[model samples]
Target chain A: MSVSIDARGPRWSAAITAVVLATALVTSNLWVIAFQAVVFAIGAIRGPQFTPYALIFKKLIKPRLKSEPILEDVRPPQFSQAVGLVFALVAVIASITGAGGVFTIAVGFALAAAFLNAAFNFCLGCQMYLLILRVRTAK
Target chain B: MPDVHYAHIDAESHLELVRKLDIRSTPTTLFLNSAGVEVGRAMGTPKRAQVQAAIAAIH
Candidate 1:
């Protein structure tokens, strides 16, 4: 069965992700990136609805919003979360291996994707998912 | 200004351009010199200093 979700939930999650990534970049904290990786893993494995940020949005933010959110299929965002998980994992591994440049680049890419989603509602990973789907169906 | 010409391509409307450039993401900035040679690239939201440094490197 296809599952739909409040489109705003992913954006809200992305906003929190951007902040967390920016903090990780600024502080150069291995633990912070590691923590975000765990968050991404959870989101990827269990779905975006079960993510910590999504829980915060459901519990704290959604009730405060005045209007109903536009719902979207959860597949794209779930795929996006998986993409984020990959980047976060790469960053975490890079950090653990003391590969600073790789870690920075991975975190930078993740931060950029998150900022785009939060600010412009442009989900790069979602777009990528669509593109892949298109290619697969075309074949 | 400063011997630089800027062109903006709307990725949504210009799918051909996006495909031609192989642009996988939004807010991708490419630094090209006078000869149309790509010198540097910054993806996503780049800091002002990063842009400045990219420009400086090309010059």
Candidate 2:
């Protein structure tokens, strides 16, 4: 029962939204960005912690409360988030430098990695946390 | 052994609670005795054995 996480739908939806938003940002598609921004704003305004897909999922499905280790609550540094931030910043700089294609590709890769993580739930950022722990403990 | 009942407090609420409890970081396990007095605490993913040892000491 514990292993049967009904997170499939939420995870996939989140992945799709992430991919679409990242692609739009990378490609500089104002329409797509605007659409996603509207959705994100609506969700955030609803509950402050309301993610777009989480809002939808919570509306349609109820989560079965069960006691589990709070490990998921551990907010260690997220590598994907860092990578996304860096890519977004670099993309802006690259646009100024007229290297749009390379910037778009870098953003695409970051978004793809995120989507891959959704499918696998094996976060590169979580791995970074493990690596940092290992290094700190080694010394 | 203290039954570790985890609570998912939001960042803002967590700040308030931590301020009151004097906890500073995540993975902060509060060990309470049967009388609900705090006996020990650990931060950041202390090994299960370490937690058990702490719990055993309290017991």
Candidate 3:
């Protein structure tokens, strides 16, 4: 069966990620960043509804919105979460390995994608997901 | 621009479109004419002015 999405879930997830990541970046707290990354990975692997941000939105934010909600396929955004997980993992590894540049770059990349989603409703990871599928199916 | 329209294709069900369009990058935009002919394309994150110009030239 196809997944029913409220669309707002992913946007809120992105917003939460952006805020948490920004905090991590500013505070230089590897532990907090690691927690954030793990949360992102879990969300991607399972579903946005399982994410903390989604839960918060469902409880506090969704009730306030008056516009009609819409649903879309889950695969694309799910794939985006996977992409996010990868970046977050990369940052985690970089921090553990003492590679500051790599950590910054990884977190920065993830932040940019999340920011795009929260601000413009665009998914760069979804675009990459399409390319990967194309390559896998090409032969 | 009246006839201009766009779509957001994902990797799950629309893999065929992704392949057919040769989409190797994110934030790609394709400009097609009324006949569904591809006349222009962009492969990276483009600015608003660039998109505006592309849509303005759409036929």
Candidate 4:
């Protein structure tokens, strides 16, 4: 069995950047942003890889999203998609409560982070993993 | 040099595809001209400049 680590932010960042660029070019209305938020929330509600990488995550050496039982060898996804699901729930509630501006701004930041990964191969998710692991292992 | 579009090839079919070619390495690059004639080949990641030169020559 081969063990593979699933930690990279470039691909996800690339996807987010593409989403933002397309959205920014085609939309200026608050309702458009809210619609996009709802779409993303649906994805989160489904699961992590449910929205992005739904096709290839299963094929990669190390998946960034988990859709199957973790192999004895393959590393788990870097982030808990369940956590993202929770955020999606919060985002949906926030939008319904007329706080969509905050969630949209956060989505904007995620888009920026994706572009950063594309240009620099930086993985913000990996950094987040490091921080979480440190906190977990700290005595 | 052969220009290959690396598509998502599955492991089950990887060996079959490899056998059809003259490739002899885990990572092999084949260079070909517009006529589909091979001019150069290499094992593993070749220098970008070298690949460019081969394609330029073919062109």
Candidate 5:
């Protein structure tokens, strides 16, 4: 049986959210960014259907799209979100400890990944997820 | 518009195909033609025009 993925919504909303999350790092907003990371984690584990971005898309963007969305793997994107969650945790830790170096690296890396996905249509987290899978299978 | 054939794989569930295709990330796209040959791809999330061009190339 095929997994019934909701392919109707705007995929870019996640990227935009990431962009905003990236801003948290710039403005040095820890709790706000931490909250964002948790939200993304919830969205990943629970499903994008529960995401505010998805809701926005469903309400605003999805209606305007002229073509049906191309269905793709649900797991990778979720996994990517999970990866995002981990980075968010790192960001939180870095923030709380006043580890500006780590905070920059962690949040910066996440922001870059998100921005790349949004702007260039490339997902660094997805690659990392696949690599993890390969390692798991190999062992 | 709705005549295209597409399938979304759960990368976690289907590790084999992912490895076979060397798929590294989400929003990765594959454009297959009538004979089941990949014509184009826009990894992450492709623009509408890009996908349309891929479709057109196959036809």
Candidate 6:
């Protein structure tokens, strides 16, 4: 089933993600990364609407909005959260294993994706979803 | 120097091609032999020396 939501919600969530991830990177804090992982896990499994950042956007930011946002399908953002979860999981594992290089790389990728969405409204994971769809249909 | 051919695919425009190639990230460089079989691949930004080494190995 498709669920429609304000497109700006995910973007707002992405802005928070970018900030959280950047802070994690700067501080080299595994706990912060772990926290972000939980957020991603909730978004991926339950839906983006259930994410903490999304809730913040809905409760604190939505009411102050000046205009209505374009509605979009929730599936893509959910998929994007799943992608973030994978990266977060990898970062967590690397941190636990003491693989500093792997942890940094995983977090770096996740940060880049989040920054792209927050700054440019470009959802890399959503693009990947569309590409996968095209590939499946082409076969 | 061996003869080498170069081709570029804009991943943003060619979604199907990008999917077909299983490219997960950008700035990915794939080296293929004359028979069109993939010989080597470099993901992310690679140094020029590294790229030359990869090409030489594939050659």
Model 1 C-alpha lDDT per residue in residues A1-139, reported as the tens digit of each score: 3666888899999999999999998887989998898888888888888999999999999999987677666767888999998998899899889999999999999999999999998888877864565444443
How many backbone clashes does every candidate have?
A: 0, 1, 0, 6, 2, 0
Which segments of model 4 are wrong by more than 4 Å? A1-13, A16-77, A80-88, B1-59
Candidate 5 error regions (>4 Å) = A1-10, B1-59
lDDT by residue for model 6 over B1-59, one digit each (tens)?
A: 54788886656467677777887655468988778899888764456787799778776
Q: TM-scores across all candidates?
A: 0.69, 0.44, 0.72, 0.40, 0.71, 0.69
DockQ comparison, 4 vs 6, better candidate: 6
Name the top lDDT candidate: 6
Q: Model 4: what TM-score? A: 0.40
Clashing pairs in 6: none
Give per-residue lDDT, candidate 2, residue B9: 47
In order, the B-chain TM-scores come to: 0.81, 0.71, 0.69, 0.62, 0.87, 0.81
**Tens-place lDDT digits, model 5, residues A6-53:** 554325755766777768877989877877787787768887566777
Give the C-alpha miss distance for residue A128 in model 1, angstroms.
1.1
Q: How big is the positional error of residue A78 in model 3, measured in Å on the Cα after superposition?
A: 0.9
**lDDT of predicted model 2:** 0.52
* Alpha carbon lDDT of each predicted model: 0.82, 0.52, 0.78, 0.46, 0.73, 0.83
For model 4, the docking class works out as incorrect
Q: Over the stretch B4-50, how does candidate 1's per-residue lDDT look in tens digits?
A: 67776554455566666666554567899878888888765466798
Residues A5-80 of candidate 3: C-alpha lDDT, one tens digit per residue? 7877888889888988887777667897898877878778887678888889899999999977866566667888
Query: Judged by lDDT relative to the true structure, which candidate is superior, 1 or 3?
Result: 1
Let me know the TM-score candidate 2 reaches against the reference structure: 0.44
What clash count does candidate 2 reach? 1
lDDT accuracy of residue A138 in candidate 3 = 77
Under CAPRI classification, how is model 5 graded?
A: acceptable
